[model samples]
Target: MRCQNLVCGLVLLLALGTSTVVQATKPEDTAATRAQGQVLFERTCLFCHGATGQGDGPAGWFLGRYASPRPRNFTAGSFKFRSTPSGDLPTDQDLFRTITKGIPGYMPSFASLSEAARWQIVAYVKSFYPGFRTETPVPLPLVGAPTPQLAESLDRGRALYTSFECHTCHGTEGRGDGPVTQAGELKDASGLQIQAADLTRPSSFKNGASLPDLVRTLLTGLDGTPMPSYAARLSDRETDAWDLAQYLRALSAESVP
Candidate 1:
């Protein structure tokens, strides 16, 4: 039992995406692991992902409309929470992280599960998409360090907000009440009416609200939503996402307290 516990812990450390060290071997998709994963998926994930991972569980029926987040269809392979580029299959780590963190206001964190069990869930989710087996996913480079929350940085962020016409969707004040929302022109991938997130409350951010999270979300965009990846425009502008993250932080403070 002592040795078995240590082996589990070691496997967890090697597979954790947050570790600075490169990941070692992942939990192999052996019959034993696959069996555990399936049981966990049915117990924890079947309400949304269904028996076969089609995002059409019994509970998935109600989440299909305006401003309502729907379950993801795993078989389609069009993941939005990936660290990899748009259209790319998310890495095993990406899926692992999402299962660990969960989406705010939509999916509750599954941190209650042991790390090994979480990895099992990730493996189960990956089983729905064949692309996970064939493609190697690579995350983008972290842009410069979190931009200093200084006046100059905020100012740069403010300027970009306008020049880039972010105001068109985010509004002059970073509220979700922008022209598009007013006109009801914004829709998600499923054609559900959608509103841009109110930047004033970072806690409500779907992807995450940390400075790095903001930067990554800005760079990657939420694939199924109207939010777009600004990676091309911000290319080589090392400070862009950083500064922008600071600006978003300032907006969040407005509603936080």
Candidate 2:
């Protein structure tokens, strides 16, 4: 009985030691991960993002000529969807979300991919820009819920729409046919012509159509685009950004069939 007990103890110790080793070698942003990501990218993303991530793949060219928005150039380091502050590098999770959800009309959702594989791709994509190595992502502050007084909130939101001069780009009726858009004056950092979102079409929102998503856009703005961050511009007492978001939501609601 004593000899049998000793063997059991030895087996338990060996099992625990193996578990520790497995935990220690868990996958991270290592060379192996990047290489696996590269392979995945070549298989899935190279058609649109390209071998160099310049958004200049053959399919990209085909799409650019016919598509309104082109594929993103990772080399530019200008991501549109993010939880981070405007002009800041997005967190790993942000990239993961973009990969999972994708842009509405332009990018296809890769949610089918394993989460680990998606993260690996994110690591590889970040490799395109050296800034990712040195910069830490700064998350934007959380937005508060709309004021309890619904009508009063909408009223304030309407006033904020005018005060913020949103009509200059989104049009007075939220049709996206504002003078700037009419003149084709809006250009992204890449000098590519871009259009203001039609506020009436909530379904077309690239980031998302949720209230929180709208508020986040108002706070963080779309980097490399004309949208400017309101986080710094709005005063602590001013709930103007939230009001604006509310107003936008109302416009979208009106357009619903």
Residue ranges of candidate 2 with Cα displaced over 4 Å: 1-27, 66-68, 254-257
Model 1 C-alpha lDDT per residue in residues 137-158, reported as the tens digit of each score? 8986654455568999999999
Q: Estimate each model's TM-score.
A: 0.86, 0.83
Residues 163-244, model 2: lDDT tens digits? 8788889999898888998899888777778888899998788877665577777888888888887777654644566677
- N/CA/C clash count, model 1: 0
Q: Please list all clashing residue pairs in model 2, or write none if there are none.
A: none
Minimum summed lDDT over a 10-residue window in model 1 is located at: 15-24
In candidate 1, stretches whose alpha carbon ends up further than 4 angstroms from where it belongs are: 1-26, 64-67, 254-257
Error of 2 at 235 (Å): 4.1
Local distance difference test, candidate 2: 0.75
